[model samples]
Target: MCGIAVIISGVRINLSSLLPDFLSPCPELQQVDYFSIDELKAALRRRGPDSFGTKKLILHSENEGRVLLSRFHHDEVDTSAQSSSSLTPDYETSLSNQVNRFGVPNSIGELLFFGATLQLRGLNPISQPLVDSFGNLLVFNGEIFGGIHVDCDSNDTEVLMGSLEKCCSCTSLEACHCGGEGNMSVPELLSAIKGPWAVIYWQNNSRTLWFGRDAFGRRSLLVHWPNAFDSRFLLSSVAPTSLMDKNSDLDIRDGMNNLNFWEELSCGIYSITMNAPKADGYLAGEVKRLDWANSTLKELVKWERTLIVPKPEMQVFKEYSLHSNGMLPELGPQQFSASMPAQMVLSALRESMKRRTIVSKRCQQPVPVAVLFSGGLDSMILAALLNESLYPSYEIDLINVSFDNQFAPDRISAKAGVKELSRIAPLRRWNLVEIDASLSELTSEIKRVTSLINPAETYMDLNIGMALWLAAAGDGWLCRECNNDDDDCERIKFKSAARILLVGSGADEQCAGYGRHRTKYREGSWLKLNEEMKLDMHRIWKRNLGRDDRCISDNGKEARFPFLDEDVIRTLLGFPLWEIAELNQPSGTGDKKILREVARLLGLYEAAVQPKRAIQFGSRIARESNRKNFGSNRAANQASAGSVVIHKPST
Candidate 1:
């Protein structure tokens, strides 16, 4: 896991103000003064705590209708160059940390890169932004579960970079003019990978920059298009706003149209030619959207997520009309129904869990794995699967957070769920960490949490973000900290040292696990239900993943979703609508029926029958937030809980 950022500017702008989102005063992360360049680095450092580095590239316009690119490494001072910051802390060119480096933008454009490493993979830590011998640069924030082969002893970042370098068939950076050819083209290489990622790769030979989130947008990447604010284009793993020049698109002062600060970059492969004619001091080359090797996925704005969801073709539906005598008939309500993909789903989800949990450890703890555990169906399944994957010597942390203190739905279920896991994996130690928060604690974090989950306002977004932030932080007292049955034993408050948190995000989205799915089924039959599920899957990237990523990573721990793995999605997509769920049945039993069978296959009975629960409600954060923010739960409930945006703070 890592935090990666790229900045391309025509004019030398104060590098300091680039990420005022990290400034830390505005309610949550919104309204704020510009931060120093060093402070910006500090913010990203939270995501990648192991190591941090940045690189600078100066592009000089040439007389021969071309651009010249040169790497800059300035250790000496430029006596003649004065600082660009003279007004109002110069929220533009002021970088007190790097005196004269960004002082002069003596080139056509300046491309700056920053990367922080979490060091989860490989035998040793590999510092990034990783630059190779030929000058190709990469700052990657993700893991390579599988696609191209990766050796256990090697770091996935190193392996992925090597694979990408092999795909670079260009001869020289000076006269390169062509797209990647053959099977190993850039798009093909990334599409084949079965993991979540957000990448920024600089191809020195082609003088092109390739960057975007994986197909599902499983990782967070924000884009600030060059607007009136500044003649700048950049990408960052986690940033609230792209604090632009004074005339930029967003009005940060009033914070009315705050979503404009930074938008989640669409999920796909995007390439920008750096050598093209300069358009407003940045690359004039049109950003190209390369198609996936799978051939089913298209631009996401149209809303067909074929990469992970079922293909919506007539022929595919026709194929499902005829049922097979697959072993799945016994699990469904019908004695004989469409061939269930239960076994395939079980296999795929199992492997996905294996890929995500079976990784190296960090923070020097015997227990390196933690689950944002609500002890609900999705989380319980993950815990059981995790127990199957890790060694018996390793302990697992179940971080359950509740604003209601002792009796939130999630807190109660978590206690029950932990007992089940203990019975199943008797040799393994499970630390059920109970993190109880009050209205005051939530008040203290309003600004930071709000900022982190920007572009996703509404009381509901806040409640969910706050719950996730607290749970991922994993700080609280262990249920058995005293190791005694006595209730009066002094409980020790300790934070889970685990750096990796496994979350069950995609499960509900994939399986018809929401109440809406049932209603849709009743209203328009199978067609409505299918469409509803597709919509949820299609928009999960924009609606949930990015906000969730920002909140979770804020804790210096990476959140891995086994349910969102590429293969897991493909396997579920293979099953017809009938096989995925039986929404006609009551809440818990029919919703996500295929996954229920998977739970049963893993010997989980009670969890298999558990119902879907949203984190905000499960943790009871929404109830508390409604009482505090809206003065009554009725008002928030009357208007959709997600309907109200936070009041814009005074500038």
Candidate 2:
């Protein structure tokens, strides 16, 4: 929902040198130039455009150390709202009050803290770079679902910070014990909540910085520590453009060569002490040094599990799932029951859809959210659920996008499904906006899509980007028929009508929808099938999800995956291999068996029987993009951009 950037150092820095034009090429933003931090804020304004704020905090240190925080909002309701007051108070203004409590002298060199928050939720935006009563500061990106213990009225970030403060306070106490452990580590805090998030939290008392992403890195965060030998670091939600200047071709090449300077921070928690030797330390007869302690940077946790196969008790197979991230609690043995699986899965789907829809407090209006519908089993089921549950109060728009090919399988299937859906659950408005893209327009559009997903240079990645970008480019159904008559009559566009996108992204991975899963089962049975499924589940962060976030969020819409819901995933994982896939049946009859049953439960008989298809192949995007240069190898196209190492969460 927002982009965040940070700079931490042991010495004074020229802010201009730290920030360069590292953004992916965006045609709309090319005319705008940015040089300073303010300009960088302007460059990322589209991510959150409603309001803006910035804060600067000086750290208690011997040298000139600093932190900066800034943000913008995307709320269409009140773009004019701007106030001089920062969400995080200027540390300089609050230093005097803090000096008395800590008994630290003014002569100590100050460390600076800076942060930014982008507001996307209209009407009531969550204030960011929030400072707690204990002086700890937090700047967070992403939402915490309402299932958590926080008040529905308060901002999730505010509630998160409150929970953290309580945990930290309890840990610092001599007589207190939380979680049955003497002192709670930072990773342990994660076990309390579930949702997509990337956070930067600074502990004022300990002068330690704790930062990380969700179990699945749904939001992107890249870190630049120019030299491992130096004590300066920079972090941002978006990748910086390779070029400093647009006109200089040589500078562009140099920028590409220097791509090794920044790296995407791995998903999971990490802790580092921000304390550096100050003039006071030297005055106290301590030697000042440039090198930081090796212990300063430590990997506190990784988003993965260590499974322990236990001795069989009675006739059941028992396993203990242990998490490296202390935040997740220990899992008990998996229990199998004949009748519970269906009901459990259905309950999770219903709740996940609810949390992802109008039931969420995040929705400020009754206006309908859009779906990236392909009319396949995954999307059709989602549409049916939304139509039957929340249609009258909220208009439903099934936006189906395709390349210029009328005979494509996806196009035919989508038309059939839409017509059927219209007959089944007629709403106040069943808007279906279908788009057809031409080969002439494909080149420019591909460039734009690639620009949005920088470092995702691959044959498969390009296919995904092109498909999602085109789908998200549409306006609403109202302008579908009127575009030809009026050149000036603008389409409503995806960003304007829907702030949230309900996508059936994780269903394929969770339910064995791929051909590879079927192949694994045919050759090696359930053992191989389970192994392959687990790997896919783990690698989801590296594959489509990360690139999908960049492409989809670029349009100011957040994509929520109901299949990836915590409870839904757990239920699926607990199922026996037979429930997931009927290995003995012919291939077509077996794949995604559990999902088909769920669809049948919902009375979506047609959807329950639909066959599996990849979005790129189903949409004919890959075919269209490669039409002109037939039989061309994708490996050659890999050179379109340099490769970025995808970090896998390890136990």
- Among these predicted structures, which one has the highest TM-score? 1
Estimate, for each residue in 1-651, the C-alpha lDDT of model 1 and write its tens digit: 668888765542322233443221111111234323445554575553576667776655555325465565421111111123221221234221221223322334566787777778788777778888888888999988887787765788899889888775432333334544442567767777768899999888777788888888888998866444334566887763233223243355543354565788888787776553332232244466665654444432233333222455554444443333242333423333332466667777788888887655433677788998987888888999899888888899999998877679988888888877877888988998889997666554766677677667667787888888888888898757553234566667979888889999988878889888899889988888888988998889889999899889988888899988876776676566666788878888899998888887777788888888899888888888788767788987886666677654445
Query: Compared with the true structure, what per-residue lDDT tens digits does model 2 show for residues 418-468?
Result: 766766775546556666666566755555565455556555577777777
| Per-model lDDT | 0.70, 0.55
What's the TM-score of every candidate structure?
A: 0.83, 0.72
Q: In lDDT terms, which candidate is top? A: 1
Residue 332 miss distance in model 2 (angstroms): 24
TM-score of candidate 1 against the unseen true structure: 0.83
Q: Where is model 1 more than 4 Å wrong at Cα?
A: 11-36, 64-67, 74-107, 169-183, 240-256, 276-283, 296-340, 361-363, 481-490, 649-651
Q: How close is candidate 2 to the true structure, as a TM-score?
A: 0.72
